[model samples]
Target: MRLIEGTYGIAVLHADFPDRIVVARNGSPVVLGIGEKEMFVASDIAALVAHTRQIVTLDDGEMATLKADDFRTYTTEGTRTTAEPTTVEWEAASYDMGGHDTYMHKEIHEQAEAVDRVLRGRIDDRFSTVHLGGLNLDAREARRIRRVKILGCGTSYHAGMIGAQMIEELARIPADAEPASEFRYRNAVVDPDTLYIAVSQSGETYDVLAAVQELKRKGARVLGVVNVVGSAIAREADGGIYVHAGPEVCVVSTKCFTNTTVAFALLALHLGRTRDLSVRDGRRIIEGLRRLPGQIAEIMEQEEEIKKLALEYAEARSMLFIGRVRGYPVAREASLKLKEVSYIHAEAYPASELKHGPLALIEPALPTVAIVPDDDLLEKNRAAMEEIKARSGRIVAVAHREQEKADHTVVVPKNEDELDPILLGIPLQLLAYHTALALGRDIDKPRNLAKSVTVE
Candidate 1:
């Protein structure tokens, strides 16, 4: 226990151990301590309720003066703070069935609307001009950016990978997606003219923050594409685009990934237009963006089929995901979601590279998820699917149109090949979610993982 006296002779008595108290700069106190293994208390009941149904939140300015069989509390400065039992009636239904059976299902259904919201009011119908309020760069500055560096972690990093392909192809700028952790540790070349875009859902990923700060130190212009309104990254970046996906309570991200990718597409297209991109091409992309939401909703209605597939594959010991070009990133994210939520051993590979290796792991019992959007590489991917099939591999193909090459087809709604990742991504996310549910794993708070990795 310690007593601290402040500037106004405001004496504060703190009794809990340092680790048990979640202290903020604003002097908010969050008590996280255990009376017994079966008894726990915290500022937020959700953190402890899983361990013990009985819980309490310490009031502001209160000092937990007594620690025994019963609870006692007092004010920080010689006054008494009242203690009360707050009746928090938490309904699981709040997170369940917003419009679907599971949170993941609801989240998948929300993607189309989410994409529309991200694109709303940001594009001009003519597609000849672009306006990004936070991007202080004018046409000249935007045109001068010859290279782009995207930094993020997990699903966001995969989105960055897709962004790189889009930016390079549409905007005609060379782009590379680097994992923030690896980017920070390496000796990277950055300059004032370089446009560094940091992608994160929480806006407070430690490695991303550190990498952006390092880039700024080298005088590179930093832009952040994040979901949270007032996150550390959002506040720190020179320019930022909000995903506006709302509070994603689930640890395995679904809506946020689609939102981020769509937002990046808008940004890339905007930059492309500003840099003298062909007017026809720009209009085509804008039209595709406008149509993405409806396509997403169409795909969401296939939940029952996806769930059934999940149940059928629930016993699979190992899974492989394959994709090429933009699909590679989707494959990576799909593999990550499966591993994180379902505890399934899943790995992603570029379809072409499977011939060199990974093909050896293919068997009738193993499941292979191929992200085969109807793109230029569709034929090659089909060829790869043939190899998996020859090896007796169970194929769960995520494609726009059903190809008879796979054992089970998860049909993604039709979209421009460049935009297929946004639609194709949903089914895989749902597959992982349903599989996790079948395995009876925690859907929101996965084991040993925090919603935001705020600390290094």
Candidate 2:
């Protein structure tokens, strides 16, 4: 009331009546009855229905300027006020690619441009070096670092596992990937020089947050690799890099996972250079990174084949995923994607570890998904396929080239082992997405789950 009078440069008054009160603003008055000291004011009748069945919506850009025994009046741009109300409306077009039929199909088609956007401006094409200005570690400090700890959950955790291998092999740095939930509870050593990197799509994951807080308490240098801007983890970390993959509405993440992996690969190569790793070797890896998006696009063209394979195995209640070495992490992610969306029971095992255990679970009713890239492990994975066949387990293989060894195969274009994960990951994601659709499961919001787990 005071603000209104002040703005209009007019004296306003209030008077008590038997069943109501008379209020005046800029010499115009409005009368409203009181019930338990509650007074309602709104811009529209719809907003006042709950408060009182009787209401009057003020006219646009007008103040309720007068109050009297039975009525009120309003006026626009009062004596001394110049403010005006403005209405704004916004609409967004659907990402749906007209009846190509599924979101997974549209997303699969978007991979090439998505990956390209994630890699843009961060690399120098002429020199093949990563430009991460926020990585504050100098050469001497990087060399002094003896251990690395990566913390995350779900798919991000699997990415961390793969990152551990890259860090160890390229930077020659001993690295460990810990499930953030477990890492927080376990007794661990951390110091000022120790580097702890946290990966999260939302940067507010409960377990990841807890682990980062614990590491900070122990005085470790913390870094965040996240997709969201100004998220909790990003604000808490000493320095960080944004994945810049944009908003991923799907509950099962697609582009963000590959983008995060690309960022980690770059970070690993950067650390390698800092620690005096061979320039020739680092450039070769960078060259592979540059070509990754196109390779993934080529692989994505096989979505129809992947969909057919998913349909073939849709009736199976249980599935097993197997991989060796770096592929083990890919296997873990594949299993997670399947279980998350399709509600199918799925498990991932290191192919080499099958003989020790997992082999006991294979049977005719279960389908096996193997990540069989054309590498040293191809024969080993084929051997595992043979075992699954011996047990009569239906086989669905994701390989670099088509193979007759399995009941079904979704082939990807071949690349080095390091780059194979990026190419091979797409079809598995598509498979899970389409399978979920076929089962009529919610693809964007799975039951009993939040996009980011923010509480411990």
Full-model lDDT for every candidate: 0.76, 0.72
Candidate 2 local Cα displacement, residue 126, angstroms: 5.1
Which portions of model 1 show Cα errors greater than 4 Å? 1-102
lDDT of 1 by residue, 204-323 (tens): 677787798888888889999988654557767998798877556677889999999888888888888888689998888888888888888877788899999999998899899999
TM-score of 2: 0.77
User: Clash number for model 1?
Assistant: 0
Off by over 4 Å in 2: 1-108, 125-127
TM-score for every candidate vs. truth? 0.80, 0.77
Question: Which candidate has the top score in TM-score?
Answer: 1
Candidate 2 lDDT tens digits, 279-346? 78777887888788778877777777777777778877988898888778888999999899889999
